[model samples]
Target: MTRSTPHVVGRLSFDPYEGPAGGWGSLSGMAKVVLRSGDLPVDQLMRQNKPGGFMCVSCAWAKPAEPHPAEFCENGAKATIWDLTPRRAGPDFFASHTLTELRTWTDYELEQAGRLTDPLRYDAASDRYVPCDWAEAFAAIGGRLREIDPRAAVFYASGRASLETSYAYALMARMYGSQNLPDSSNMCHESTSVGLTQSIGAPVGTVTLDDFAKTDFLFFFGQNVGSNSPRMLHDLQKAVRRGAQIVTFNPLKERGLEAFTNPQSPFQMLSPATTEISAQYHQVKTGGDLAAITGLCKWLIEADEMARAAGNPALIDHAFIADYTEGYAAFADFCRGADWGEIERESGLSVAAIAQAAAAYARSTAAIGVYGMGLTQQRFGVSNVNMVCNLMMLRGNVGREGAGLCPVRGHSNVQGQRTVGITEKPELAPLDVLKDQYGFEPPRYEGMTTVDVCERVLERQVRAFIGLGGNFLRAAPDSPRLEAAWGSIDLTVQIATKLNRGHLFTGRAAYLLPTLSRIERDVQDGRPQTVSMEDSTSCIHASDGTREPASPNLRSEMAIVAGIAQALLPPNPRLDWGAWRDDYGKVRDAIAQTYPDKFADFNARFRQPGGFHRGNPARERDFSGMEGGRARFILPPGLSAVGFDDAPDVFRLMTLRSNDQFNTTVYGYHDRFRGIQGTRDVLLICAADMDRLGLEAGQVVALETVSDDGIDRRKDGLRVTPFDIPPGCLGAYYPECNVLAPVGHHAQDAKTPAVKGIPVRVRP
Candidate 1:
């Protein structure tokens, strides 16, 4: 454990990959999974992203019409193999490893143990989980739930659940008098939903997949496109081949944005050719996106004024703005007065780069602004999203073909969950529809979000915690506090597909309920079934699987949710739990009943090829939802979204996903795209910062948080590694670096934790 060594940081294997992403690297990643998956279900792999197949559980990227023969990406294949692995972590496996010992394992090692095969209940006497019958587990859980105040319980759902299952979960929570219905969006894209609703009068993106083919210019901010959504590479390639311009502004120079070679292409597999994705890549500082985007707005507005002064055709779309927008005068004034020196200093970019991006946008007839969590996870995440909207509305980029704001979501059905009423606010919940369909008034009290739930649990205000999916404990920003808060709860139930560290944090009464994954056949009522999911573009698709379930004891997420609802609520004709579980069609019918406008022909439309568009009115230029029937040009709160202007020698740290992992699940130890392998506990810092601190690559160091929130946080023994990140910033894999993002350090107005730009100082 000397300073020269990696400390607890596992062996660091570096391979600086030179070739473009998605060629040999993506193929090799998929091949390794296939070789390891004994008796692989090749049919599932072949049918993924196609009609009559399951949507990818990895991301929410839209599935195109007439998809390629192999529609799945490298990470999607790995997730499939991981879900369908022959290995099992059943009762016997749990009996051997005590909960205390299992806590010491890495996130990768814990999940790599394989899928769960049986229901497990924590044994307090033995300090280990033991096998339990579903009846007993459900009964005990139901009994404890019945004793507690329903309002004190939190029903958390994951993006992996189908829209049908999410609908059921939402209805069940309301039936039981709890509105604390928080899902994955609370942590990732809640800002996108909130900010867009305030700006464009809609909560979803206005851009459709067809928009990519027609856009003349695209502005990509903060998102690492290739690693998060490989399928999006297809759209980028088509846009480039159509002579469209793409500009990228991110702290790190992501390989996916640099160049891409489609793995499915026969020519790409044999040669070294690549399609360049970004025409101009600007390395903005972490939390600098607001300033950078505002700079664009300033340049565009000035250029427009100059064109008008010269008596030429106006650069701005005055007709569109007059007819379709509000607050133009005020928004224009703010941008006109913005100082270029401050923008340049804050954005870590030269005036020339900002001017270059502005010139490109000015040359295009249509443009789109695309972003990811890198923008939404900042301290001012809501404002970050509003700024992007402001930039779009300045030139009438929204509400036209190939022109709009695109928020690249991480989870597959996260947006769908929100569409179906998985919300904490009483105003956002479908209370009236539930009252109409079920003949009872639902609760109207405001409920808790992810952060609020964690705070309540820490205060012992929560009596029960139930998760439909996701690693709730590991995903929390302040790990030590939430881990203890989770243990303080009276009952904790996790309906999951695999083993993970979250399962090890046994509460007073805990149960690990194994459920079916998307890759499995969810036959119900003696008939094959299909569930639906909503992609990022508001398109709904039906997903069906042909492979067998991982274990006979496992049930579908819908079945498990229905069983719990039945066990807890009194019998009622309007709410027939058995019918909902017996046939997913009944669930869709109920959803349609709840939201006739969006799900009018739910089951029918979802069965069609490439499914149906749920219809975003924003795309058709409908702004009646906003005041004065027009989109609003929002003013940003300030120049810097991340407010640590005076913190000296502190690196702005953001959590990242390696090419080998998903949300909180690690598939391997390598991040081939970034050229780092064999470890997750390493901190990526720039060489100048290393020199400034008198440190070198491979030196084990500590990162202590610079916060006034009175939470003493530090991640020790992280091996320092030189990277191409902006000078005063650092990057590390998520969940591994989640401890640095304090719970209270979140986006204003939205509760998404500020994991993208945490202020910390490195110490050796």
Candidate 2:
């Protein structure tokens, strides 16, 4: 590996993500940013994320039935102010800046230019984007879409798009004869959807927010609770107060899991008070979760055998296993046969530690398991998730009160988008039901995923691309390659609220369509409209915006979808597109008509207080979707090692988000949790590896991927920082490091990009 340029040294503090001072720092930083935005309405700012007000656009954490006085977190406020800021980037702003010049701007700088005020299209003659009318923009987009085969056009939906908007978008795509519904989920939680459905016959989380109170033990894996799901801290505090044990597994010892001082707690407001979160923390190697789970099961199975030999009640749930599950005997035999030494070598955990965690699980009356992308973005992601279900099922955890599986979603409305038909595989939603309701035959063939879409575009198979909302270029793996591949398309359109790098990097013809944010009021046919969003717990609630649009020219996402639909397909007697656009209730009614059993009276139910729970059959011990109408304990193939199997010096790299960022959006330069300030270009490695490489904390180095594929994937100019991670593992912030993740390397069954567990080599 060869280094290109020296890295800029960034200050690293030894403090945790949040304590007394850290809590106040977060609030102060949020306040300063909000105030700098200028002249924000007092009432709207105060009531921003509370119930009966706009929902927070930050995360997908579930809210309590009764809203707290301060319903928002620091990141929530950042997202709110960022969306509702007074700054504007109108026609004049674009006229002064060329695409090449704009491409030189940092992600933070680009977004800080603020809300887009008008629709703009790239004008080759001027070498800049120029103002275009909504009608003209839609006409151009529709014309190009019609010229190409629908299979050649890709429709990408971001999680920020509301259920109503997504429903309309999905309908339009299928009506145009395409099921290329690639979405943010394909990059994030596709493994959760695939694995959970295979394990328990459901595609979403089975646990509710209230289950935290009744759970005796909570097993958390691969999630930074404080930075990602801040509001969850309160629930964790309450759970700790009630004597529930919290166990965590991660490569690094995150401060959020160690201890937390809730900013909203009255008791901690006056003085420095903190609550300990994880009672036991295991430092699992990156991509080593399957091995860790296998180890736990191995111990639990042995304990059950011993207990049964002693004439005691079996440690396992024999009754539940006999009645509602299949393949338990084979799974148990494999678990019992697993080598403890190999498990320890792979998982980076001692046999005693695995037994300790298993003992906690065995003693608990009920337990809940929670995980995130750390378990999903790997070669064996589905197997890892299935092992989690296997461990929980060993004790009849699923379908019981206070116990179930919770795959914490990273984005707001991601679950809802999938529920309303934003999926690459149309088979998930009944074609007969949609055809009966909308009088259109949805494509039966499975469409492209994120990686598949990129491959098609690279091969010049895809001609047109439309992003509902997101910086797809920055979010995907092998970003530079994807950027180049995008140029082959004839046209690209971005439905967005602010400027982003994706808008600058585009096809031959590109358009940026400004749209309303979550906090902006939307009106259709002289009546205020509300959008429904589903939380991580599958709770659907109505969010009505309060503030006026940042720009009057902006259109609601629903209207924009309708505009394009009308332009391409026009109105027909069978489907009145105008009615769906005029009133969102009609969209919800249509949703109920298509999926009547789950969303009965969708309009009436979503408006009710606390909203409605889209119940899962698996939650009630119903595994009818399986071949035998029982949950199957699918056996694992073997260990999916994080480090290279043959290369002794190879290191596993894990990509993560900074506390100051959300997905691909950079809110600031500081990462308070990791104690790094003002930079996002440092590599976190264990001190032993640092010594072996003879590198100092601020030493600049390059990383080159070690793979059988000859294509070189490298990230240069990264400063090395010694930290407490597994010996053979390293960590870096994503979007910057996304360049090293190969599009060809992804989860086996899910097809999600393998952002984590990339094998790499260090360069001096």
Candidate 3:
């Protein structure tokens, strides 16, 4: 065999990017991805992020109340072009590629092959996908769904789908006698929903996009807002210009958090437009967020006690706590008694650092706490979230302008999906309301989520899987195991715009249904349709696709779901699937009827500028949803680690997306912010740890998971790169490192996979 030209750490570079975050570099990246899919109309690009145009389904960052000249980001362009690409995967392409051959391709290669232009089904004998009529595919799916017990089938929804589509799909699942409706939220922000709802009587963020301008302090914990939500950087820059303090706590020093130059500024284009993002940046250890936040709370409590002793105004919101919240006395006792030694050891930060963070927080009048998967994808994920809320509550931040908790969501419409009842666990009142409106008895059983679905599929409990969007195989944890379980299912249906690995890993029988993307116009019965989306701030807005359908065969997601419902359920005058499919307005009316108070005048409200704000009780300090009609300060299981007792040499492995990719879709191999290019196979480790472990910079190592489950989980051939990450903490690209995370390991309260805090032993 020829010498493999031994890879030498893949050209690791520490040269930081100094220019504005989104100037020429972002434009070039956007052009490269967009041009790869062939040229598009200028109107299509201009219409993106405009009022009366489509929302960028790239992220869930709240848009401005009004439209700007360019409201899109680099990732938004990538997502739009990735879906509306001119390249087509037709019969000839499938005929030439076999299942075995396609399985060998990388995820990027699989998706980059092209968009699925027609309905296709797996032909086991030929080991390739063959064309199938839409009616035949729908019939096969509906018939199989009917054949199995509804409890054995799962309906999965993705964030890319519209609100109307998700509502219809949820109704169909409930009508079919199963509530096994798991959506993408189960993987990303389930902890936020569980913790926030339990703590403050609401599951959504209270701060709107405009709140960034009025805040005194913004604390970002375990979130890379710049990389994940680039548009938010503009707001951070403005916050800094207005003399507000923005602090960041994370394992690695994300360059995006250090400084950002607003590309939209002309002054920045002429001179250095550098705006310091974090007034104070603290690098917290992996899985150490609970300890860190608790430490901050402890400092805040001590400061408050000292302030009261000095006859100063109370630092803690005593009036608000006494009147609006409960359990403060117990929570205060715990924080006052917290050990500084353990806090420092666990958080990997000195007492001074925690005090510094507390000082910034204490000095501010109004503050906002923001976080992402770094806090949520842990064994103590819910506790981590609750601690953040506890911190906000100490200063009377909840239900107020410029203050509250904000869990930065990854997808554009994931929040919207949850708002429209795309949950596995259906509330009894909502089910009753939907039943009364639709004239069908809805399923009342608690359904499976992402983690639960994985377990059930492995145990052969689930027989059929129907996905509205997203790459289920790649997004789920324990890929090798999930792939096997997914293949063993009786029937699998994927409704998507592009080809992903999920479509190739067929079940006993699988069908691929192509659907129109977010940017494509969905004209039902000759009238242009509009769909609503909820932002991170709980603001609802209408998104109307402006471009023509990518293909003549491509059907809208609503149309496909309606067709399936019509095929499965007998025709009925009360639940007329045909009329609803023909007119989305009727569907909106039904939504309003189902939740009259929340979605009043659905059509008219959706037509209003920036849509309309759903009534948020938390904003009005209405704690009726909570116990005893008051917000509760919950004391969670104090602090923990992921198999920390297993091995002394074990390191916490965090699975994160590179700047080049979204959740699972790889736009390119380069991560510009981290300065790595053309590869995702390198392991990022601290320089001190590299030396302590006796590993060279270019060494290729094997990562073996440290667990008590007795099952070996290992990934090999990862090049070691010494970087600025925290010691005892390692980072790797996801989907590749997903195999190292056991399916049994998940957040206790939320059931979200603990992908961020995997215990792994490295070997050269």
Candidate 4:
């Protein structure tokens, strides 16, 4: 592809001279960049930094450096670059661009503009957004909200919102008498939460960052760390250096797992001394993860039996099970009952492969099982996660250093939002505490989740949606359906740093409130402010951005949320909303008081350099659930592996991620790792599958939806590219491919849409 081809994946075409080096050095160097726009070296940026540096509002990953720098990761750079770009959307910009005109732009084009400068309201007659006073916008929104059925108002929270703002938003929604709290988590790791909560008492990861260095074996299932979570590469490298075995089970062979050039090593990047990541790579078929894990468990059980018969030490951790677990006998019985042929067939892996993986786990001193959305976005997503936890519990893997489960989160603050109580179902204790501390009874009704919100909107049961900071309409699945649903709403408010497709899909009396970017300074009560974020490891830290606000008219998310609350609630209310708005410390104080068990003295703790680590129940091996203690394995029912009666022409379509793109955010077109550039329109077909279908590389083919439902959602025109993938499994990008997915198809328990493994038929 020529340079003029409008690269979709920015990093692939990024010139080394345009920024820093391509790999780790570039990442470390960019890490120093202040959250703001100006170009400053790492040392200078750090020197000028106060407490709050530049925090990416998009993701909760904070750059809290003593001396803030302009450097960030490739994805971080993409986020920062997108944030710092010299673009604006003011009244005039909107005046010249009609809502109809803006809708014509692609998702990427819309967000490329820096920030929304003024609060905007859509005018039906003009078909354009007009600037409105903050008070007018707030009052208008409050009035519309009051008119809506309390059950109909769905309040969605993005990870980008500050902990203080998120709390205020949740409180306001509750006070308004709605339980509709749809969040990004519903789309990502709700399965992890559901599955883990069943096995252990919590949904978060059991291990901390410190555990990476201590773990002897690392099992990565259904995740591509290098592209999704690059910072994890550091830990993988560290573990490899320490002689740890990292086994990866994924459908596609990810480049990051094969070898990585540690930019930290002077010679590695300069030369070719790259570190190999995965000791054993298993290309299990899509939807075969559960079966693969089951096979491993079966192998371990057989090993334990063989060892006992040989008069040797017990292969399983029987002591741990007796002292710290429950349901062992049941789990063991289930494992014993698993048929080998069923395991092999369902897992799409051989019995020997399962045995090899099991032997590795049995011999390891400690093992950490890490996964991502790939494991969670399936028809059996919740069961898939439970099986992983079941395997870990059987071997007594929890509550120990280097031995736990890690669900890699996408947005940095996505995990943090949930940590700070952004949920549809807040526990009774937290609810009572919130009421006692704030003097208002939070709505006791269970709130609507993401899917529920979409369905409610479609049914006209939901009239207003106030988004803190996400491209909601586009971020969701069934975009066409969601867009139509959003259009039916009475009021839609988006507080964001940049223009996105969501902003364009506005409702009547819609408001686009501009907010301060994480890099910018947030001041209240004559003091600079910082927001706290909870990382994947359950580490809560303060994030302070260093850049100036894109526009002076922009307000911080906390201020915007509080302002809206003040407008909505009566003056003689239980909570002192005004006081909290004046001082963020007051908000933190409330948070501390509300979550005393988890966060004590939130203000003081946040002052600490790296922030504070929250206590994990599993970390201490405290399985605080039924049976009066220990974690237990919940064995699932076995089924004959579901396989297609091979029609010689049909191929299963597996949705994959391109290196240049994130969930719904496509940065550029090039997937350098996949050796593809300048296009997302191509499909990855196994060479053999292509041959059997009488197709070759670069063959133009149509993918038809093979669902029993008479829905034809696939685009009629798509080019096929023969690539390396397991036979019977084809690869395509998401959102585009999401059309082919049936709305009814989702995880049995978690309700997460099954995006990864979709069965389809190929056409010539």
Name the best candidate (by TM-score).
Answer: 1
Q: Candidate 1, residues 330-366: lDDT per residue as tens digits? A: 9889988889999988899988999999889889989
List runs of model 4 lying over 4 Å from the truth.
1-52, 55-72, 426-429, 572-574, 639-651
Ranking by lDDT: 1, 2, 3, 4
Global local distance difference test of model 4:
0.73
The residue pairs that clash in candidate 3, if any, are: none
Query: How does candidate 3 fare on TM-score?
Result: 0.97
Residues 68-155 of candidate 3: C-alpha lDDT, one tens digit per residue: 6777777877888887777788778999999889887778888888877888899999999999888998888889889989998999
CA lDDT scores, all candidates in order: 0.87, 0.84, 0.83, 0.73
Judged by whole-model lDDT over C-alpha atoms, candidate 3 comes out at 0.83
Error of 1 at 84 (Å): 0.7
Clashing pairs in 2: none
Number of the predicted model whose lDDT against the real structure is largest: 1
Task: Quote model 2's TM-score.
Answer: 0.97
Native-vs-model 2 lDDT?
0.84
Worst 10 residues of 1 by lDDT: 1-10
Candidate 1 ranges beyond 4 A from true positions: 1-11, 35-39
- lDDT (Cα, tens digit) per residue for candidate 2, span 664-698: 88877677778777667788998998888889987
